[model samples]
Target: MANTKSAKKAVRQIARRTAINRQRRSKMRTFIRKVEEAISTGDQSAAKSALAAAEPILMRAAQKGIVHKNNASRKVSRLSSRVAALGKQA
Candidate 1:
């Protein structure tokens, strides 16, 4: 219903931003899942490497506002713990 010109413009901007943010968030999820999958498979070295790769991507996501800082930190913390647990279990 965005009757105002400004309002309609905003809607278009939001749609474009949504697509970009969704892509960022999806990439973050993929990295996180890769780390988790490595952990699940009991590959300590691969898990460690995957966590390394995921960490920076996540931090970038936080900086870009695609993901909240605290949420990203929590995810990193939990993923780190899980990676550590994989080592312990081995």
Candidate 2:
């Protein structure tokens, strides 16, 4: 549908960015889920470890523009607080 060469190039670039962004979103979700799972199982150590693994990935997602920084920070904050609370609750 892109008759102009420039339009075709733009389409190609969009596709590439979309694919990359999708992968980043999926990975971020997976990491967050892992942290949540660790917390749910009531293992403070595992929850802490999972948080350690996920925090940087979330931050990197923000830095790469895949997600907003405040959104990322909020998620990280909530997750960290939840994980921290596991220690007290246990």
lDDT of 2 by residue, 1-90 (tens): 999999999999999999999999999999999999998899999999999999999999999998999999999999999988987876
Q: Which ten residues in a row have the lowest lDDT in candidate 1?
A: 81-90
**Model 1 C-alpha lDDT per residue in residues 1-90, reported as the tens digit of each score:** 899999999999999999999999999999999998998889999999999999999999999998899999999999999888987877
What's model 2's TM-score?
0.97
Candidates in order have lDDT scores of 0.94, 0.95
Clashing pairs in 2: none
Give stretches of model 2 more than 4 Å off.
none
- Measure candidate 2: CA RMSD: 0.7
TM-scores, all candidates, are 0.90, 0.97
